[model samples]
Target: MPDLPPIVDLRQSPTALRVQRGVMRFLRAAHGFSCFAEVSLANGRRADVLGIGPKGEIWIVEIKSSLTDYQVDRKWPEYKEFCDRFFFAKPPELDPDIFPPEEGLMVGDGHDAAILRMAPDGPLPPARRRAMLLKLARLGADRVHTLMDPGEPL
Candidate 1:
């Protein structure tokens, strides 16, 4: 058999992970979004950053570290069904104008971030809102439990 190429772990890369951290920090501090990183949705999609606001508003932010990252992703549209608002978060070096005008934009620098455009609200049905809320709560609790007891299974 032909030798296989070495596997690449994009999630562990410094740039991508740093962008996520900065986005998360900005969401939590500035936007009051108590978020869960890498949240799994009902449609078998994983959200990069899913946050729940005080008013139970669901907001999702998809991080794109570079132009290539943004261009390659086609799943972003699917996230809209699961949230009240959607946004794309990227490093300041990226051109925010490339993102869809209908969606929101945020720029990050591995420590802080700013929202360049606000996303329009598309309220979710009560049923979906309830389901998402429950899921977020469960995920958050699971993480806390895992932190408290490293050996525990989630």
Candidate 2:
């Protein structure tokens, strides 16, 4: 096998550090409304941030430094199964619309930070939605292993 490049530490890059700090600050502000950060899903997928609104709406926020990161990842669809609302966080220059139209909300910075809610023109059937939600709930509750363990009969 060929050698791979070493991982670059964002801490050493001023630009990356600034963006990281911005994301942290945004998450902190969200915490005031009962939102929290770094919530882990049962499948080992850690959402960058998660928050529940007073009315019980679940929000999932995924942060990216650039549009390319948003485009290449496959996890966003999986994230949709878990939350009623979803958001992508990036700098003001990045256009959130680059993502699929049906996926989720787009939150960008301008003035003091603003959000645009993107609705899926065609939604999944209610039954399918419920199934996905249940799967995600189990994952979040750390019960996925029970379902996946080979020792247990299906």
Candidate 3:
């Protein structure tokens, strides 16, 4: 078996910090977005950085210091339901093929950040898209477990 790469703790690694800085800079320059670091979602899931794109598209970025951390989290599916775009950030050495080819955005360079949008092709109905956007807006504005308790709106 091929030897697995050693995982590094992001909280303590300079490379992880640089990747984070690159992600922040990329978001700022590409989308004029304000990165909400470690924002708690209604489901008690915290995203590394949530950015609102210029077109009102919601982006959820999950940053991992190591490939192993990314593999173990397994929460990207939940994030997809909440945001229009879902991204995974880590060092470039991590293979993007590890992510689901149809549903994940890979973001990072060994020294900077790069992103690939993996949204499916074809257009959603305007009404459905608008409704989803509204839900995202509400979720971003306040915290409520609408996703959990379907009867409640926050």
Candidate 4:
């Protein structure tokens, strides 16, 4: 392989990883969304999980491994600007009551998961939605390209 930029991994704890996997599986299996992880939005905030549905609807999922993890990460609110709905996913051990009802809630483990609550519809403006779709498409394409051609710059 030729010289390529070193990519920074989005490392998560085993618990966090399990939560993420379950959320991803639930979204794809239940909602038919093509989910992507660590997607950086235009505002410079990276969403832990982002999904685009068949009708171009966007959703962002933030995984919290524990109560402390939830307290530490307050950036989830900013992610709302970029998606039609926002959700928080956590392991079954984490209590769902802690999450705000205004947003969605999901519970899962390593294998599979389910959405406990769905976020209210908050559709993006037409222009913003278009821009976001373009960004997601390009990002998805670039990621696939990197997997295909390892030597390419990310």
- The TM-scores, one per candidate, come to 0.89, 0.54, 0.63, 0.91
In model 2, where do residues sit more than 4 Å from their true spots? 1-32, 109-111, 118-154
lDDT value for candidate 1? 0.82
Model 1: per-residue Cα lDDT over 1-154, one tens digit each: 3222111225544766777788889888987889777877888888888888888999998888889988999999999999999999888888888899989888887898888999999999999999999877777776666556666443
Over 1-154, each residue of candidate 3 has an lDDT whose tens digit, in order, gives 3222212223436655666677877887877875655555657776676776676666777777776776687776666655667777767766666766666565665445666765553343566467656655665454334334545432
Ranking by lDDT: 4, 1, 3, 2
What is the alpha-carbon lDDT of model 4 when measured against the actual structure?
A: 0.86
Name model 3 segments beyond 4 Å from true.
Answer: 1-14, 109-111, 121-154
Using lDDT as the measure, the top candidate is 4
RMSD in angstroms, candidate 4?
A: 2.4
Cα-based lDDT at residue 118, candidate 1: 94
Better of 2 and 4 by TM-score: 4
In the predicted model 4, the residue pairs found to clash are none
Clashing pairs in 1: none
Q: Cα lDDT of all candidates, in order? A: 0.82, 0.53, 0.62, 0.86
The full ranking of all candidates by TM-score, starting with the best, is 4, 1, 3, 2
Q: Which candidate has the highest TM-score of all?
A: 4
Which regions of candidate 4 are displaced past 4 Å? Answer: 1-8
RMSD of each candidate relative to the true structure = 5.8, 9.5, 10.8, 2.4
**Worst window of 10 by summed lDDT in candidate 2:** 2-11
